[model samples]
Target: MTRSATLDVLIVGGGIAGLGLAGYLARQGCEPTVVEQATEWRSSGYGIGLWSDGLAVLDELDCLGAVRQRAADPNRIEIRATGGERLRQTTIPPDRTLLLAVHRADLHAALRTAVPADWIRMGTTPARIRERRGGVDVTFDDGRTETFDLVVGADGIHSTVREQCFTEWTLRDLDTYVWSLWVEEDVDVGGDMVSVWGPGSEGFVARVGDRVGVNLAARLESAPEPPALDELRTLADAVDWQRPALLEETDEEPFFDRVREVTCERWRTDRVALVGDAAHALHPIAGMGASLALQDARVLAQELATTRPERVSTALDRFEARRRKPVEREKRKARVEAAVTFVESEPLRRLRNGVVEHTPILDLFVRQQAISG
Candidate 1:
């Protein structure tokens, strides 16, 4: 088959992982084309807790200030029980200089704005998957074929690239599902994030922007029946700490959902590899997927920039090895919480919630800064 324009690298998916890789590669002077299945990217999802690790990657890529200006709220978080009983409270990391509670759309918009429009090809996906002489050749849905020195699947879970590149393997599913909702803040719920544990489920709620309060619910095992908006309202109403003032102002609620950390057996192959959710889609309950994904993107970039192009496969293996440990540990932590929060034992559930309510470490868990090259 005849090949089209050559690329130093072809990155799939235009989400944070894909854009982050393209941005860093562009800075390194490598030609990269980011292909997204979606015609237009949207940041309408919930807010992500961008920790120092992810921030450091953004810093190196020269977009940290925009992130800070748009996302960082004053560092403070609270842990509580069903009512307003304060379990634990702390000023978020003082040394990190800043922490963020930015909305999903704002961050996406910021990243998209920084990338050259030509480097991003929206509404495109890889087609006619086959390994070739230099690397891989892909014909797109548009009937365009292109070759690259390297192919990175940043497309996310259910990645077609992953299915085509690797032998069949199991993606172990963790018995948890996450539901997130955004509502206008009615009252001040403090500057800190709030995480609450209940029987058979856990909740994380925080005010990120001027009027947005994001709530996340993670339930263990098989997912429950279909839920409606009122369930979250009921759950939010259940929290009386802020009471009338808080409930009065909250309006225009929207809900989004996902499965928890469903682990895959591996992350790379010759001339091809996975990054971000495509490779290591961790539990959002950990609030670390974005940060971790940014770290993975930077790691892939550092390896590519520093290593010879022919060593791409080796670099991918090393990247996977470097990230697998941290990802596993965090996954295990989330699993433990899932077990406690979703257990049939009522007393055990209460105690777990009790500790989160009182535990100062709630705000200290995810570290998001990038490693220097």
Candidate 2:
């Protein structure tokens, strides 16, 4: 993959990781084709918090200004009880790291626009992937077979590329369901990111400019199919503040899904590799998914751009070796946080609250999360 050689690269999944990688590679003089299953760009989902590391990647792509224009800067993060009593609060020091709360759609749009339009092929996916001597052969859903010097899977947790090329992978169900939506109605959040936790449930509310974004998560014995509006209302009954307005403004189709994590012992083969959620999907409670994806894009693009075609496998190895530690650490942190925040036992919940109220546990957690790795 020398700068002069035209290394044909195919990136699966056109989400944040894929697009970010494509943009970086293009800047390095490599043209990568991205294939997404969606027919058109999806402007869905609630908001995401981007720390300095993610912002740095956007700046490298020359899209930081575009993202900041549509994003909201939050100076504080607050944790509250069900009755709106603030248990802990931490201020985001601008001198340290920056935090921006932007809708998921806006972030996706910014990354998508940074990549060339023709580099993406929508409405189709790779049907089969076969690794050869120095390259990989990919068969698309449209019955076309093509060979590329390298194939990277940024597809996501349920990645087809991972399933086809690798065997030691599992999608661990977290036994939790989440509902998220963004509404234009005003809610009193004081322009801060606020999270409320109740027994077996947690809700996050953040003001993105004039609109507000809400995310609700609850632990369950089993994951169910998409629930009806009435069922969602019942779930919202756990939280008091802004529930009425959030329910009333809920769209006909809101984001609802089971939370799962992807764990893979190996993220690459001879000519194929995985990045972002495809390799290691963490619990959403960690709020590090998008940031990790951006970081993975930067590292993988760097490895591939500088290596030669004959040693593409070594490049893939270097990419995984550099990224696996931070990703695994965050995965463990997310699981621990989820366990503490979503405790169903009344006694344990009270003990957890007491510890959080008296100690600086929440503040420490925020600081740990602020580190971009």
Question: Which predicted model would earn the best TM-score?
Answer: 2
Question: Could you tell me every candidate's TM-score relative to the true structure?
Answer: 0.85, 0.96
lDDT agreement of model 1 with the native: 0.68
Residue-wise lDDT of candidate 1 within 190-265, one digit each (tens)?
5467665544545666665555455546443444555545455555565445533454555544545656344567
Best by lDDT: 2
Model 1: number of backbone collisions: 14
lDDT score for residue 307 of model 1? 57
Candidate 1, superposed: residue stretches over 4 Å from native: 1-7, 93-95, 172-175, 184-186, 220-227, 237-253, 341-344, 353-373
List CA RMSD, all candidates: 4.3, 1.7
Q: Alpha carbon lDDT of residue 263, candidate 1?
A: 57
